[model samples]
Target chain A: MNLPQPLQELIDQFESLPGIGRKSAAKLAFYLLNVPQDRLNRFSQALTDLKVKTHKCDRCFNLTENKRCSLCEDEGRDQSLLCVVEEVTDLLVIEQTRKFNGLYHVLYGRIDPLNNLGPEEILAPQLLSRLVKEGGKIKEIILATNPNMEGETTAMYLKSKLEELRTKKSLDFKISRLAYGLPMGASLEYADYGTLIQALDHRNGF
Target chain B: MNLPQPLQELIDQFESLPGIGRKSAAKLAFYLLNVPQDRLNRFSQALTDLKVKTHKCDRCFNLTENKRCSLCEDEGRDQSLLCVVEEVTDLLVIEQTRKFNGLYHVLYGRIDPLNNLGPEEILAPQLLSRLVKEGGKIKEIILATNPNMEGETTAMYLKSKLEELRTKKSLDFKISRLAYGLPMGASLEYADYGTLIQALDHRNGF
Candidate 1:
C-alpha cells in the first residue's frame, strides 16, 4: 500500500480505536481525506480538547471542567440520595431516564480482580470519604453498578464497608442495590436463566 | 446526558465518519477519553496532517505528498501501458496484486447522471490531453473501471473518446476493458446471470 505518509498515519490512528480494524481504518482514513480541510481541523481540535478540557469532579469523580460536576453543583437535585455507578457513561444513561434527580458517584471502573483492577483503582476510598464528609445529609446510597460479576462484587464490598461505617459513626443512611429483573421490550421466552431467576425472585404484584 | 462539551464534540466528530452511528460514536469517544493524553495528541496530529501534508498527484490525480505520485514517478514501471481507474482506492487494490506495473490515471469518480456527475468532474479532459501529449509512445490503455453500471458507462464513454482521438490524431494506442467473468473462488451456482453470460462470452482455452 503506497499511501501517503499522512494518510497512512491517520489510518494507523483509526485502527488503534477499540472496534475499528485495519480495513475499516483505511476506509475511515479515505473518508476523512474527502472532508473539507477546516472540518478535519475541527475534528483534530476536538480530539485535542477532549482531555485538556475535562477532568474528574472533586465530589463524584464524573467528568467535568470545573472542580465539581454540574450534577453535584445543582441544588435542586436530591442530595439525600447518591447513585454509585461504574463509569460516567453509566451515569449518563441513568440521567437520560429523567427519573433519578439525585447526585452520582462515578467509580470510573469496576473491580476486576483477575485483571488486577481492585476497588482502590476505581476510587472506592474516595467514595467512602465523600460519604463520610456528606455526613447525615445523604440518607440513602444506591449501589447502581452494573449487574455483571465485577459490578456485583464491587457493590457487595461497598455495602459491607458502608455498614461498618454506619456502626462506627452511628450514621443513619441506608445502602441498597438496584433491583434485578427482566428489561422492558424483552420477551420472557428469550430471557437467560440468570435474568429469569432474578425476575422470579424480585417479582412485583400485577 | 451531562457529558462534557469537548467529549460531546468528539462524539459528534466520530459520528460524522462513514458507518459510525450515534451509539458507536459515543463508545469511541469514551474509549478515546481513557487513552493517555500523549496518545490523544498524536491522534490529533495525525488528523491534522492528513490534509495538510497530502494533495492530488499532478499527473494521475492519485493522492500524493509530491507533485506526482510515486507510481507515476517510478521509471521502472511500464510508461507505455496505462490503467484507468475510478478512484485511488481501486488503484491501490490493483497495486496490491503486483501483476500490473503500468502507470494509472485516476478519474476520481465515474459518470453518474443521477448525481449530476459527468466526465468534466472526473478529469476526463486531463486524461485526453495527457494521452495527446504522450504522442505515440503509449501503446495500450486498459479501462480498469469497475464492472457496475456507472463504471461500465464511464468505460464505454472513455473508449469512444480514445477511438476518436486515435483516428483524428493518427495515434496508434490500443484501448481495452478488463475481462468480465465469474471471479475466482466464486461458485458458479451462486454467480449472477450477468457474470455467467460474460464468462460464457469470454471463455478462454485451457
Candidate 2:
C-alpha cells in the first residue's frame, strides 16, 4: 500500500478505464515499470498528445487527426448513403466487414433513458444538421445503432425524426434499419428465442 | 485511418499493454477524449511520473517509492519469516489472506524455460544474499509460488538453491513449500487427478 504516489496514480488511472479493475490495473502498472524508460516516456507523451492533438471531425463527428475525418472527405465512398452508428468503434467494425461503402455519422452515444442519456446528450443534432446540409446528395440513411434495447429505442426515435425531416424538407432520401437474424454460422439451438423469432419473421425466398 | 498522430499513438500505446488489443485500445483512447481535459492531464502526468517515482526495494525487489518496500521496513512483521514469491501480485494475494505475518522476497518473475527465462534473469541471487545476511535471525522460509507449472519449477529451483545456501552459511532456518490440497469447499468429484493425489499424499491425521 506504500507505493509511490505516481505508481499508485498510474494504477488508479488504468482502473478508471472501462474494463480494467484493481488487479489488472496493478498488473499493467508493474508491466509498465519493467518496460524501457523511453517507451514509457513515449507512452506518456502519447497520452499528453491525445489531449492536445485529437479533435472530432466537424462534418461527421468522427474522431480525426485533422479538421475532417478521412471517411467524410473520401471521394471514393458513396456520398448518397450514410450509416448512423452509436460510436466510432462501430464504424471501425463496419469498415472491417468491407461490405458497407457509405459514409458514416458517429453519434458517440445512443439514447439510454435509464442512464439519463437522452437524444440531446448525444450527437443527434449533429446528425440532423449533417443530413440537412448534405440534402439531395444523400439518397439513403441507414440506422445502424446497436441491436440492444437502447439501440432499438434510438433507432425508432431517429426513424420518426428522419421521417419528419423528409416530410418537412421534402428530402429525397430513404431510411432503413440493419437486419436482425441469427449471425452467420450460428446454430439455431444456440440462438436466443428473440433472434430465432426475428430470423423466422424475416425469412427470404430461396 | 487518418487519425491524428497523437490519438493514433495513444491507441498504439494502449494496445501494447498486455491483454489490451486494437479495439479495446481504440475504445480507451476515445473514452479518454470525452474525459475532462484536466483529468486527462492528470492521467498523463501520472504516467510520466510512474518511471520517475518508482523503484525496486533493494532488500526484496518489490516495487516501492523508496529504497525499501513497506513490508521490508515494517517493524511489526516477523523478520524471522520470509515468504518467497514469483511476483508482487502474488505478494498482494498472500497479504490479502492476512494469515501470514512475515516479510517477502519477490522473484519478480518465475523461471519460465520455454520463454528462455532462467534464474539469472529474475531475482534469485538477491534472495540468496538476503538469506545469508540475515543468517540465524531468520527462522523459516515459505516458498509460496503459484501452483502452476512455471511456479512449480521456480519453487523447486529455489528450494534447491536455498538448501545449498543453508549448508554454505550454516543457517538454522527451516525452508518449507506451501501446502498443496483441495481448495476449501471444492468438491472432491470436481478435483483433478493431480490435485487429488496431492491432497491424499498430504492428508493430515484426524
Candidate 3:
C-alpha cells in the first residue's frame, strides 16, 4: 500500500501478536503514531524492560527478577505445598485471589498433541527432578493446570510420573488436583478471583 | 491487583491509549510481553520512528515527511481541484481509489460546537484563503468531510463561508460537497474503497 516503511514495520510487528489481525495492527500503529511522544517513549521503554528485566525463576519457571520467585522466596508462604500451573499468568491469576500462600511451579505451556507438545515440551522432567530432590520437605503437590483437554492430559501424565517417582524414591508427598468447578475450556485469565479461590480451597486429591 | 511493577507499568501505558479499557489494556500488555524480544523491539522502534519521521505537509496538512505532500507535488494531479478531508487517514483512503488526481487538504479535525470547535478549529480559513489566492485557475473545492453530525455541520459552515468569500473576493470557483450515499453515522474508516470511490464520483455542488 506504499505506507511509510516505519508504519508498515509497526503494523507487521503488532500483527505478529496473538489474536491481533492486520486491520487491528494497522489501527494500533496509527493510534501509536497519534499518542504523545513521552507516552510513546514510555511504551517503548516498557517493552524493553519487559524483555530485558524479566527472567524465569529457576525453581518455579515463573517470570521473576530473582533466582527464586516471590512465592518461593517468601518465608510466610507454605513451603510444604506447591501449586503447579501451566503458565506464569496463571500464577498471577491465583495470586490475585489472595488465598493461595503456597509456592508454585509454572510449566510455561501445556501438552498440546495437535502442536506436538508432549510432557517433555513443558518442562515436566525439571519439575519431577525438583520434586524428587525435595520430596521430604514438600507435603503436597497441587495440580492446578487449566481445565481443558490438554490440561487434563498433562495433569494425568504428571500424576502418573510423580507416582512412579514415589514408588522408586519412596516419597510420601500427597498429590492433588485443583477442583474443576470452573467452566470447561475457560482460561484462568477470565476466571474471577473469588471463583478461583473457591476452586483452590476445594481442591481434591488426584 | 498486585502485578509486578514492570507488568503494571506496561498495563498502565496500554490503558492510556484511546478506546482501550482496563481489561483490554491488560490483555494487550500480556500480549506484548509474550511477543519475541526482536519483534517487540521492532514495534517499539516503529512507534518512535512514526512520531520522529512523520510530519504534516506544509501545503495540505496531511501526514508526510517532505515539505509538500506526494499528491500536492505531483505535476499530473489536477491543481485546480482540491479535496478537503478531516484527517490524513482519509487522504490515504481517497488516494487508494486512484480515481481522483486532485490534491488534498487535511483539516486534522472537524468543527464541533459542543467541543468548542468553530471555523478556526479546522482548516476552513486557510482553505478559503488558498482558494481566493489561487486566482481563477482553481475550478472546484470538494468538501469531503466525514458524514457524521460534526462533518455535516463543518461542511455547511464551510460552504457558507466560501460563498461569502466568493462574493467578497469576486472569485469564480465552484464549491462542492461530497455525496453521502453510504449509511449515515458510518465513519469513512469502515467504508470500503469502492463505496468511497463511488461517493467521491457522485459529489454535488453546494
All-Cα superposition RMSD per candidate: 1.6, 3.4, 6.5
Residue-level lDDT of model 2, residues B28-93, one tens digit each, is 998897788888888878877888888888898888888988888899999899999988878878
lDDT of 2 by residue, A1-206 (tens): 45677888999999999989988898899899878888988887887778677778898878787789888878999989999999887887888888998898889899999999999988888888877887789999999999999999999999999899888888988899899999999988899999999999999999
Off by over 4 Å in 2: A1-4, A111-119, A147-171, A180-183, A186-206, B1-4, B110-118, B146-170, B190-194
Predicted candidate 1 versus true structure: per-residue lDDT over A17-96, tens digit per residue = 98999999999999988899899899999999999999999999899988888998899999899899998889989999
Clashes of each: 0, 1, 0
Show the lowest summed lDDT stretch of 10 residues, model 3 chain A. Answer: A1-10
lDDT of 1 by residue, B94-166 (tens): 9999999999999989999889998888978889999898898799999999999999989999999999999
- Residue B151 miss distance in model 2 (angstroms): 4.9
Leading candidate by DockQ: 1
TM-score of each: 0.96, 0.83, 0.83
Off by over 4 Å in 1: none
| Candidate 1 chain B weakest lDDT stretch, 10 residues | B1-10
Model 1 local distance difference test score:
0.91
The residue pairs in collision within model 2 are: A65-B4
- If you assessed candidate 3 against the hidden native complex, which CAPRI class would it receive? acceptable
Instruction: Give the candidate order by descending TM-score.
Output: 1, 2, 3
Of 2 and 3, the candidate ahead on lDDT is 2
DockQ for each candidate? 0.81, 0.59, 0.45
